[model samples]
Target: MVLILIAMQFYSPTKNISPGNHTQIFIKETNPSPNLKALFETSCYDCHSNNTVYPWYNNIAPISYWIDSHVKDRKKNLNFSVWQNYSLDKKDHLLDEIEKMVVQAEMPLTEYTYLHGNSKITDKEVVEIIAWVKQTRIIYQLGKQPK
Candidate 1:
C-alpha cells in the first residue's frame, strides 16, 4: 500500500492555468460589484473557472487527482472562464442556478471550505451574490447582450 501510494505521486493531471484575464468576458457581461468580484476570486473561481489557485496539498497523490476531477466537473457545470461561449438563455439559467446554490449554501462545497478557510461565504455574501445574479439576469432577459 505504501508503494502504491508512492507510485501514485508520480503522475498528476494537467494543471488548469490560463494566461491573461481569462474571465474578463464574464466580468464584462455580468459586471459583479467589486466586493462580489473579490468573493468570486477568493471563494469560487478556483473550481468554477479555468484558472485555479492550487493548494499545497494539490502536489500530493490522490488529492491532486481528486481536485482535478472536482474542478473539471465544476467547470463543466459553469466555467466562467468560458462564459462567452454560453448563449444568453444559458447564461440566464446558469445565473439562476448560481443564486439557488449560494442561497442554499451548496456552493464553495463544504469539503472545499474545510481546506480553504477563507472560501467560506458568509450569509451576507450569499445575499450579495443572489442580488448580483438577479441584476445580471436582467441583461440576459432583455437580450441586451453587449458585444
Candidate 2:
C-alpha cells in the first residue's frame, strides 16, 4: 500500500489551468452584480471554471485523483469558461439547474464546503443566486423564442 501510494504521487492528473481569461465572455455577457460575481468566484469558480485554486491536500496521491475527478465532472456539467459555446436552450437549462441546485443546497459540494468554509452558501446568498439565475434564464428563454 505504501509503495503504491508513493508511485501514485509521481503521476498527477493534468491541471485545469487555462491560458487566458477563459471566463471573460461569460462574465461580460452575464453582467452579474458585484456581490453576485464575488459569490460566484468564491463559491462556484473552482470546479466550474477553467482555472482551479488547488488546495494543499490536492498534492497528496489518491486525494489528488479524487479532486481531479470532481473538477472534471463539474466542468463537464457546466463550465462557465465555455459558456459562450452553449446554445440558448442549453444556457437556459443550465440556469434552471443552477437555480435548483442552489435552492436545494446541492452545490459547492459538501466536501468542497468542508475544506473551504467560505464557499458554503448562506441562506441569503442562496436566495440572491437563485434570483440571478432566474433572471438570466429569462434572457436565455427570450433568445430561444421565435422572432
lDDT of each: 0.91, 0.89
- Report the lDDT of model 2 for residue 35: 89
lDDT of 2 by residue, 1-147 (tens): 999999999999998888888789888877788888888888998999999989888999899999899999999999999999999999888888888898888987898899899888899888888888888888888887899
- lDDT score, candidate 2, position 73: 93
* lDDT score, candidate 2, position 143: 87
For model 1 the local lDDT of residue 42 reads: 86
RMSD of each candidate? 2.3, 1.0
- Tell me, by lDDT, which candidate is best: 1
Model 1 residue pairs with clashes: none
The candidate that wins on TM-score is: 2
Please give, for residues 1-147, the per-residue lDDT of candidate 1 as tens digits.
999889989988999999889889998988899998898998889999989999999999899999999999999999999898999999999999999998888988999899889889998988889889889899898895555
